[model samples]
Target chain A: MQIQTKAVNGVLTLSLDEKRLDSKLAVGFKDKVGELIASGNRLIVFNLSAVDFIDSSGIGCLVTCLKLMGPKGKITIWGLKPPVESMFKLTRMDRVFTLCSTEEQALQAVNS
Target chain B: MNQVSLTIDSRPENVPLVGACAKEIAGQSFSIDKLSEIEQALVETVNNCIEHAYCGSEDRQITIKYALSKDRLFVEITDQGKGLDPQCLKKLTAELDYNPSDIDCLPEGGFGLNVINSCMDEVNYRREDGKNHWSLTKFVVPLT
Candidate 1:
């Protein structure tokens, strides 16, 4: 799995290039998200457009990221496909995180 | 073909390797749906051994063995750590109080057993010679 991060208009956009997020990639995932939050990038956007499969471990890693960001630091997640979107809904994390339909929408929300 | 046997050493680092072997075995005979169920089951079971059986201790290795026949896929996952408690399996299988928020957020993980139970047709846990033995099976459920 590869993670690419860039700053756009003070919003950090992270694109995940991976087919699946499971146990094997969970730790590295946590580390990268932690690095982003620690770097003072409060407004974060996750681009999961490329992620096809996600399991419980993957969901756990993302939940940790959300918790670390806190209320002050906003995190918007975008581009979740069906099963991936279903997982978020199942876990009720879809409610906790500000989920956007597109990257542009997330960026717009960040700007607002 | 009678059956093919595949084995892998017990190590958290080796979980994915063993899981792949299980996936291949399951896919050999079953349809895609069964293949996915078995794969998810194996992935979760192996992850459980790696995370909880050893509790992140580097000293132990988790051994996985798979046997595939025309009728079913059988998997045995062995962990050289503290054996699993039967009560835990019962609770998880029943989905008793399995609130997602109750999940721990520590870099160390959990939930392997839950996913495994949800996916597998049958799950059995035992302890022999101080090693945790977990057997999972997903057979072709005959359509009525």
Candidate 2:
């Protein structure tokens, strides 16, 4: 559950530096991201560039983060690998969450 | 046909280890995306067994077997725990329900089996002799 955090244009961008966002680290991942959200970061760009896999639990974890962020808060997930993208598609999360293909798009999404 | 079998305690951390094994075994049989899908499906299955079947009881054992033929790969998981309810399995087989608009209405879990069902070409579940069994199959295009 290692995350590299950077701030751009007053938006927080957290890059996940892991290979899989599965059951093993789902809870910790959620809590860490939630903590950032709680600490007054309303707009977030989650970089998943290095992540190759996401299970249902991991998907659920992201959903929980969205809820934790509330209505005014937005979290954009970008840099989805092919498999990561497919999980979003299969679960139809692509419709609910803001999924971006690049860091610029992610930053733009959260900023908007 | 070639087959491999291994066992692990019903721990959440162990699921990915098994998943990685499946990916390695899949090798050139599937594309990188397909391999990732298979690994996700396998991880979902084992997570279900660890949570629903074993009730998060880390002391229990889960056995996973991988068998590969010329055209398909099969994964079977066995656990000495409670079997899934028929109603639940039916829902997972038939439904992919979720709220696409309201974040408040979204579900936090219960989509594991649905992912498995969607990723793999075939999925089956049964209970025999007090053990729960889950069988998953994926059609592969082996590389030359």
Candidate 3:
């Protein structure tokens, strides 16, 4: 999985540059986020605009990241395509994670 | 009707390959939405087989057979590993009957079977001759 990261107003925005976030890339995705968290980056936004497919393992990776970040660390996600959005809703993960429609909204969510 | 079969190692890396194959086969007749649903169900079923049936054993093999008719698409996923436990299947079916809205009580895992059940039109499981077989069907009208 290719992830592009940028820091804006102390918020780390990691954009997924892949079409699918399935089991194949779940472990690597988790590791990359782990590295970012280790570097003291707490407020994170995942831009998933390009990803159209995600499976259970992919969802598990995100949950794992959220748990690792703990309560103080904030993680927001935006740019979820409809199918991917539906998966989050089906598993009720949409409730657990902060979801936004655009990057700006996600930034505001993390900032708030 | 047309049919295609795929055999892959029981590994996470092989999932995308099999998924692509399924998409290509199903895409021949169904709309993108239907294809997406089938792919989602297919991934969940294959993932379950890899995780539970094979238990990460790379040596094990998974065979996926796709049969496409005018009105429906049929998929059979088979693994020659430990078959599914009947009690667990019953429990999962029960869990899928209710959708919990509470995030605090939301389950992290054990949602794959539910996803499959929700996406596919019909789902059945059987174990015979030391092989676990999962049959999934999706009814669709071919795109004009």
Best by lDDT: 2
**Candidate number with the higher lDDT (1 or 2):** 2
Model 1 segments more than 4 A misplaced: A73-112, B94-109, B141-144
Candidate 1 has a TM-score of 0.77
Clashes of 1: 4
**Clash list (residue pairs), candidate 3:** none
**Isolated chain A TM-score, each model:** 0.91, 0.95, 0.96
Q: What's the ranking of the predictions by lDDT, best on top?
A: 2, 3, 1
Off by over 4 Å in 2: B142-144
Q: Which ten residues in a row have the lowest lDDT in candidate 1 chain B?
A: B100-109
Q: Candidates' interface RMSDs, in order?
A: 4.8, 1.1, 2.8
- What is the full ranking by TM-score, best candidate first? 2, 3, 1
Displacement of residue B58 (Cα, Å) in model 1 is: 4.2
Q: Please give the clash total of every predicted structure, in order.
A: 4, 0, 0
TM-score of each: 0.77, 0.94, 0.91
- Segments in model 3 whose C-alpha atoms lie over 4 Å from true places: B95-106, B141-144
Ranking by DockQ: 2, 3, 1
lDDT of each residue in B56-116, candidate 3, tens digit only:
7877899999998888999999999887878777643554433333433445578798788
